[model samples]
Target chain A: MDEKQFRDYLSSYTDAEKALSAPMRDTIRINTLKIPKKEFMGVSGLKMEPTFYENGFYADAGPGVRLGATWEYFLGYMHTQTLSSMAPALVLNPGERDIVLDAAASPGSKTSHMSMLMNNKGAILANDVNWERGSALFSNIARLGVLNAKVTVRDATRLGINAYFTKALVDAPCSSLSQPYAYKKFTPNLSYEISKTQIKMLFSSYDALAEGGELVYSTCTYEKGENEEAIKLLLEKRGSASLQPLGVEFPHEPGLSEYGKEFRKVARVYPQHFSSEGFFIAKLKKGSA
Target chain B: MSHVTTFREYLQRQFGAEVPKEIVLNEQEGVIRAYSKTLMMLKPSGYMGFVAGKVSTRGIEVKSEFAQLLRNPSRNVLALDEAQAKAFVESESVAIAEQGEGLRIAKFGRHVLGVGILKAGSLHPDFIGKGRKRVENSINP
Candidate 1:
């Protein structure tokens, strides 16, 4: 692989490299399932500024407050998550009546967020392929008071539940190159290799999705193969898959547009744009071919 | 439904709450759990659900997992001030005046901390939570 060419892709966006190493404030979301927003804020006794996302705030814990060890956290009143990571679920927008599939849910930040979005009224099939990670997923799910999810431990690509989910989320694990010094952990050789497995997860997400159902494919990496090209391949093989505009009103650039291909509907959030990690999000609809 | 009937009778008799009509209650090996009824249609695995309580000859002993779900119960509650609540989570037992025979839900102000035992007016914390690791009970940013 042309490692230099792959690294050069960041030149397409402003401050992409600078954004990579930016330090960000601790951001947390009030778990409204456990406590109301206003009530949480009142009891938190910490100074906080609201972020762009709903029920999210950029928190300043001051001197002694360990957000993780606090009674509020233990009681499932709040969760720590990045602003960029929170967008995919907001765009997916699983409602109170939707049967959603969180295809790669673990440590369950998105799954718990989806439950909060649903007001804990809908069903979520939260699955992760690894048993080890699945335990952490349930821990978060339990800690957040998420009663609407059915946790499953299985190979996501082998999941053959067809047309059962009204909406599905595939927050596929990537090289995490968006983080500062993350490239040292994952070499460039793994870019396409990782996307290969990502495509399988996508196929499973598409399969489980009901026709005309919304699918949100997201990754924290900026690899084109994992980002745009994989979706391009999916549209080619599965003729019913079509990209839809992601309705996130945040600081982000549109998906890479090159050659004669048009990927204008997809969105890429640069870390510098929002002082959060980089993310690539695409909204798609599954339909009958 | 006779699913965990004893647990059901215990909840109603103790908290004056019916475990919410929308929740599905299940018991296995004497431990009662609760989950969203709609999600169970998927026949989910790892539905350990929330560990509401365990059933025995004395009826049900509430688990800390069910503390937040209860608003306020009419009977069998052990109230603690902020200082005692902090000390209790660290596996400390506080002396008391009222002689309750068994366990009661421990509360700090409006927040329900977990289950505690009251024997001969000595309140013992039976917490199954982060405090088990000797956590710094401060609210960190």
Candidate 2:
């Protein structure tokens, strides 16, 4: 979509077009499993302020200071992630003793965060279809001292594992609409194909979830087809599943209700609202299958 | 039986520590992996991979990625000063004030970076690799 067309499409939401061009913020999450929040903040030299997420902080790193090179980072005490990217895991909110599945974990930003949240207590099946990405995920899991994670390379939609998980995160692959620089190349066909795959992945994730378990489906794109429409399709197919509100406080708009009432309860983070990347998150609860 | 005993003995000799009872040490082909019962259950079918580290003639040489999982601080651990810690992360060898023998876990403050070999007064931060460099860039940049 062109700038004008995109603006017209999101006419209902103020600043949606302007937010697309705004500079993104750099945010980091402290790995509480490895280090306490206060201790990590004391040692990290960067100027930072806490985000809505308790462990997350927006960092104003100076030109010479590389947040990734710090000793704390080497110790897996912190991860440089976008504030929006950190939401799905928090929304999923897997307990310390719950077995969780990271459906599309790669390079493991969310997987490692989930591991930290679980305090490395329960097992996490971190799977990715690509071999190269899977290796990156394994390395990150190891570097971050995530002992509870088991790496696997397989198509998430076709994963043959029979074991049911208490929680699951489907950070579906989508068009790079949220990426500030990728707006020029956005196309309708690409969005449709990604939406189809996302719906398939969601169905598989729901099947893997234990009855009465919860799952969070998220995408970085703001495209309604990839976000709200995909969730609507899943809800249609799986009658036992229903959307749940994400009870966290952050700057966000409700998911587009035109798709469904459940979508209205879902959450969307626009860049204009928080100086972060655009993201969509919908929490689903599975009833008896 | 003898091989298992030798491996156990090597673990004790190298780190001056004993493996936790919950962790089972298994040898496949030539690599040795330490897996808890929970980890074994979580393993995917047809998956052949190491959970802990590989067993080598030198000792049970832990993978760099698995280095942080080692909690037992032994004589093998070499705590570096601020300057040496910076250099060690840059993949540079630094001189230690006091010399230690054998493989050492290179630590900065309370955090373990990875393993290194100390001979004489010089410490070779061989464990510093892509992961370390990535960490270094995040801090130094």
Count: clashes, candidate 2: 12
lDDT tens digits, residue span B36-140, model 1: 776666645655455666777765677765656765475777678776777776678877678657777777777777777888878887644342523355542
DockQ (C-alpha) of model 1?
0.42
DockQ of candidate model 2: 0.37
In candidate 1, which residue pairs get closer than 3 Å at backbone N, Cα or C atoms, i.e. clash? Answer: A61-B141, A65-B139, A65-B140, A66-B140, A67-B140
Best by DockQ: 1
Per-candidate local distance difference test: 0.77, 0.74
- Candidate 2 global lDDT: 0.74
Q: What lDDT tens digits, residue by residue, belong to model 2 across residues A130-242?
A: 88877677666656666667777778877665538888999999986777546567788888888888888888888988888899999988788888887888788888889
Clashes of each: 5, 12
Task: List the candidates' TM-scores in order.
Answer: 0.89, 0.88
Give the range of the ten consecutive residues with the poorest summed lDDT in model 1 chain A: A1-10
Residue ranges of candidate 1 with Cα displaced over 4 Å: A1-9, A12-14, A259-261, B1-3, B28-30, B43-48, B56-61, B90-97, B120-141
